[model samples]
Target chain A: MPTDVRLPENDLLALALDFLLSHGLNAPQGHSLARMLVDAQRDGSFSHGLQRLPGTLNTMKHPRFNRHADPAPESVSPAVVRVDAQFGFSCLAAERGIDALIGKAGTIGIGLLAVNNGFHSTALWPLVERIAAAGLVGLSMNPTHAWVAPAGGTKGLLGTNPLAFAWPRKGKPPYVFDFATSAASRADIAMHRNAGREIPDGWGLNGQGECTTDPAEVLAGAMLPFGGHKGSAIATMIELMAGPLIGDRMSRQSQDFDHGADAAPCHGELLLAFSPDIIGGAGVGEGAERLFAGFSDQGARLPGDRRYRMREVSARDGIAVSSALLQKIRSQTA
Target chain B: MPTDVRLPENDLLALALDFLLSHGLNAPQGHSLARMLVDAQRDGSFSHGLQRLPGTLNTMKHPRFNRHADPAPESVSPAVVRVDAQFGFSCLAAERGIDALIGKAGTIGIGLLAVNNGFHSTALWPLVERIAAAGLVGLSMNPTHAWVAPAGGTKGLLGTNPLAFAWPRKGKPPYVFDFATSAASRADIAMHRNAGREIPDGWGLNGQGECTTDPAEVLAGAMLPFGGHKGSAIATMIELMAGPLIGDRMSRQSQDFDHGADAAPCHGELLLAFSPDIIGGAGVGEGAERLFAGFSDQGARLPGDRRYRMREVSARDGIAVSSALLQKIRSQTA
Candidate 1:
């Protein structure tokens, strides 16, 4: 049995690119997906990193997967950029429209980008971070497959809908936070199940709607939204904004579209961008710095601080990957 | 001593208007404030209704308040509406800019209203509902005084930030949710303390940063965020967006500006409006109705369902008010 092995970031990117390209993805599509995965691994987000590739490969082989579809961006209005992902992965679609989104925001002080008919499985922070890097405030959210229950309902009617926010700062990374509205992410429960570990309380309910600690039971039934009704309301808001409000599939509808094939959810996403320089005047960056100081002074961890630390470590040393997973990737291309 | 009294909605509005005008607010200012309070009462959001008037009166009396100041709205860019509240209440300022906001969103698919140099203590739902009533989606958030602590740290550094969202619906009231990021609203804790009841766990921490059920201790110390870290992150985002990002005061700075006078916190509020027809296509409302049906079918309560139910009852039976509170209102103008 091969153990965990370390690989350079470039090497990891190369491996991911090879796997995606061999699976029939165009160069642009393959690069976008590979870049996001490599970045996730560099930041120690293991669940969103290489571990997701196996599932991606499977989804790619599905009949619904559009191997060569080209995402097209349309300027729907002065401040709105709508991108149709052409039923392909959302990565290249987002990449295609981000510049237009940023340009509109820069000129008008506010902008919105709506991505419809897309598949989103990666973390949202990457996109928000891109907006922040351009010295703008970013807010993004999207719906996934319906796996979580509405608060008070036993049946699954909501996705593990995720919301992400980023604020630009001076001389450092943007203040970024991306989180699932569910008590825990689906990936978290999957990890627990794979490890044969019981989940903690409040994570999910069994098929009968009773609380369950068994990962398998929760997986078969429904995951709970965090903080009871409050979290549920947020999740509902996300579903509306990222789904119906964007003219795309809601979580339940997305799952139904899969027809039990278990592919990545195809839906839509909404991103709002605001220019601090235009909206707040100058010195906005300084004010944001003060807020960051408040967090550090209170000994409170900033949302993405740990990830940044891991990023530095990954830069100094290579990312660690399971040896078997690497061999599996190679075998796919063979 | 009189018992609980019942008053028609018009009478309540007149009472609020009388009190505000007597306290030196201009006609438009007084009307805006009165309309919001009475509407809150009509919806059974008692905490944000007449209960908030005394604080507004006090803030109006404070040296920082511009009693006769006129709120001004200026178009900062193609899609941005900036309103200066002129150190007065935010209600009149929001009223001054709302039409422009709706117009911009209608024209550009998205619009942003940034209200700066304003004092806000009322519920945020009324504003978002107004946007939704105009057939647009609305999102609004603002930071209050520093009354809550971050997730892990003990000291009070974050505000009890409030976020509100609304979606337009056809042939019915809009779907809406407005909530504080705190585990419990400050008013809720105050009610418990006044009733001599212990608070539930996770609501707050005592002065030493230890969890406590004593509402008094919590009031003296710090309120906890709902959903722990996730809620804290949202709160922090609110603080930045409504504060520094818009050239307004952060919670701590707002508190400092009060100089122990305990007036309403002077800060800014941000509202983003989106036109569903321009972005989401014509069938968006139908899709949203389907999602609402999903909730009702599963016996899940939509966020604003109870409040809407109460609204109908208030319209039918009039509003019931504590006689003592009514007497106090009369005494204010005596």
Candidate 2:
């Protein structure tokens, strides 16, 4: 039997906001952080939604991770900005960076912003979707803690580094795509392990580089690239761009998350936004509308259409959360 | 048995160049085209190397695919340029585009160039590697004829749609990576079919969407994405950016190759080049050197190191072509 429980979107957001505020986050920080988390839930990315709130709050309460730092943006050019997150919540820093880039793109047709020295910014889709909602295309990539292996290597050398791209469509939802280059995410493996299910071969390898179907082996070894060498190559490219390009430490050299002062893991993000009007000239807007309409008419759905539809359904009805997870959230907040 | 062959690198280049010139290409075009093809052979991509020469020459002899047309730079901006290929050979157009963007990137730290109305550009890696060799990071993506299926659809809604990226390293060949986003390339399946071998299940599907190991089924149906939905998503994003964004006809909508001028099979190419100086300021060069040294010290070879080594070997010992293919090439020119 499936567990059934419901929560109003506003009530859930308020509760999360209150929890963050009580945990010592500033008013603005608390609100933005809560809103981002709720948005993920509303968008149906439950893995990154309310499930991550407790972990985030715990990390904040730890003396090693600072919660009050504010990001300051440094300008390299009118089209480029770099922000120092000052060990603050990544949600706020990323939002500020996105806003700056979107503003610049509106004028120059394109802009690039990099955020260094930040925490894990959840669900990259929302960030790109936000830019798309403002009538612009967005591309973003970030490196996380090491969780996956290079193509032929058995050791963990790369993160489940996620890359996201969002394109604005005419009347339908924006074409938003967010994915980890890894064959299977750590979260997926954990879920399968908990359900006492065997994993598929080629999803990962045991510690000795031999392919394995044991979830426990994957957890202890390394996650595999999605499509062998091709996915591995893409992840490597992301590491070079999001890691070294942004002047942040690579995933393999990331600081230990358990140590006190060094416990705050620094994540690097690279974002690019552009307006087609600047390039396509007079026919840009109408052409885009016509193009998207053609896609829609041909039974082709945009990237984020399914998620957007799911969100609409949940909003009209109510959000369903596992009773166990709901109780755990209440316990932690209390 | 493989044919034994011996010739100096210069001798082979001269022979290839002469062959192209005799077929119809001008001096500059023929030279660049020959070098690109030989480079592919030297780098071990035999499929795109001299093996494809017979087909290329035959295609050029026909009026539909022009070899003498000039690839003129249409417009240039600080950060972007547009090129009209004049329906020229795609290899030469790509070479010109990469050269222009690399030069522009030296000033702006990043530059984008889009080429429209071009033919099948051979392997994308060489173009990106050329830009990377100029101390700039580069990426290129192009959409081709309909050959692969969308995520849920069984029909060919997308091209194999290859994307390539290269990063400049201080003391090593750029880390060049390139791949088609399909589960298995049509070429690979064709080879299997020619050898009377069964393809791996899930590599392709028949028109009814049923999995088939028969290579003939694939020829009549569509190739699947590399890693199912994940690869499909990446292919879709590539199509959106490289196809619609460039105002080019897409996939099935593109004109048939058999229809000649009436078949304006427009393919779109997107190039992005970035200079490390923009990110690291005065320390850019030194930083890249140190990073490359560290990776080397840790037993990590650069991405294209093997290919570069292979090229050196091939140069010292000439590349061998099949007698059958060589005979075909001679017949075409005769």
Candidate 3:
């Protein structure tokens, strides 16, 4: 059993920042990355939160991703922009890109930003929420390492590319949805493997392309695409849009972290922001509010409401962490 | 077993259109609707193909949706347009919106269109493909009737909101992807029911909100969101964007089809078009071609490649439809 720990949000953020700083990251980079990770946990996405810190730190220690690097924005047009991550933390690059896009959209009613040459940023929902809270609709997608199989094939060929969307609703939290195109995530498979459990059929395959229950074989082979070919096609679309659209390496170009020489993970992200006011003209805000009220009346709960409530409870009661994981983190920090 | 019936592509399309016309749809409307449905089947997406036509026809007979109605474009801006579906076939309205947006985007580089007061439009991929084939990037989303359950809850509160995106690629089929936010589509549940098969756990729930394998339970309850809360959030976001953003009734304000009331089944759709030539200033076409080639090298296959191949095969051979389904369709038409 793991003991529950109650730390103030700010305290947790500062501690994370301190750890990053000690690992040679500058103040701005440390704080930005810390905020992203902490926000993921705060949003109840623990898998992408502090749990991912160790892997990120390991990558940072390698010389390929320089902590001192800065992302520079390249303007393609009034409505389009691109950012070169310079092998830095993806969280920082994503934040800059999102902020710039939101600002540009505020002026132009729509904006597009593409980020290239970066690492995995935390959960994408927080970025969506940030953009949505700014009174704009946000759409984002990113391609990562290969984990998911195509619809019919059994071998891994595509990343569990995640897509996210956010919509602002008056008097309610903005609805934020983020998900991988895979039927099951690598984390879920890892959990099953940790518990020596068998995965459900159709979730993944063995190395020989046959269905497998053993978590290890499934992990060694490929995770199935959600809803079969539909999901595979969607994931492929994300890869093309995020990878090639932004001029970054795609899944095949990605280095196998387990066997290849350590290299900067060349991930890419695409984001679009649109203002409802611009589209709806004069009474857009009022229209949105009225629409949301109608949905509430119809017994519709906002998408993120439950997660938000769970996060609030967790914050108030403190988060629970596995004892072994907590000990590992403490040892690393010490 | 499905018996293969060879038919030329043109012949299959003509036959489908003829079937629709015999059921009281006007020539243009029937042609548009038939093309959309046949395109789905040709692309190997049997669920959204002719399988849905019978239900759609049944809904059309309710008098709320006027099969002969025509959509009139309402210009919101030089680069923005709105269309009232006149409670008619959404396939017609959606195609019209796509054409209008593409035309506007050709001049402005970006076009946004919203469609309201429409009926179900099958397979969003075709619209995206149309936009992509026109040398533009396209994004679309729609909100439908409640069929998806929220993350933790077992009750139906949202439609299986589908999203589609496409991008122009050089020397290859344009990338096009379409998928619903649900773990499984209502069509999949119906298929299981027809087969007298038990569904997998987590696909849906019973009327009492308890998980069950009985396909009948799913029909009475709700389909689960893909990836739990993440998928639910996406559905909610889609509802917000597609519903209110397009000025349609939100989920709660939506009328139930079970009531057999004469109210129109309102559907909302959002379409966006972006021209690379406008965004990429000089050498835009070359840049796009280069990007496409680079992505293909990275194992990024075009989204619609498989479907296009399937269609080619079916064109060379013929469409394979189950005897039972064909007989059922013939009886309904007879």
By DockQ, the best candidate is 1
- Report the Cα interface RMSD of each model, rounded to 1 decimal: 0.9, 3.4, 4.9
Candidate 1 docking band: high
Q: Model 1: runs farther than 4 Å from truth?
A: A1-3, B1-3
Top-lDDT structure, candidate number: 1
Q: Give the distance in Å from residue A286's predicted Cα in candidate 2 to where it truly belongs.
A: 7.6
lDDT of 3 by residue, B1-334 (tens): 3545645567657766766777888776788888887788777887777766667666677657787878877776656778877778777887777778888777756777888777775878888888988988888888766777776676777778888998886776776777788888777898899999999987898897778899898888878877566566667777777776666755545546425553334677888888766654444445345434544554546556779898888877776555565556666763
Residue-wise C-alpha lDDT for candidate 2, range A180-291, written one tens digit per residue: 8889888899888889999998888888767899998898887887888888888888877787776775666553453444333567788888776664444444544543
Give the alpha carbon lDDT tens digit for every residue of A55-123 in model 3.
Answer: 767678655676887777777666677777777777777777777888777766677787777766577
- Between candidates 1 and 2, the one scoring higher on DockQ is 1
Question: Considering just chain B, what TM-score does every model have?
Answer: 0.97, 0.88, 0.88
lDDT tens string, model 1, B1-334? 2226668989999999999888888898888998998888888788888877777876886788988869888999879999999988998898899999999999989889999988885889999999999999999999898889899888788899999999999989999999999999998998899999999999999999899999999999999999989999999999999988788888998888888777888889999899999889879999999889988887998889988998898889897676787778888853
Error of 2 at A251 (Å): 1.3
In candidate 2, what are the lDDT values of residues B1-334, reduced to their tens digit? 2335545567657767777877777776778778887788777777777666666654564455666777866444566677766666666676777767777667656677777667664788988888888988899887776778777666777778888998876776777888899988878999999999999987898977678999999888878888878788788777766766665545554435534443323576878887777864555455345434544543545567678887878767776555565555556553
DockQ of each: 0.83, 0.35, 0.21
The 10 consecutive residues of candidate 3 chain A with the worst lDDT sum are A255-264
In terms of lDDT, model 2 sits at: 0.73
Model 2 stretches astray by more than 4 angstroms:
A1-3, A61-64, A255-265, A280-302, A323-326, B1-3, B61-64, B255-266, B280-303
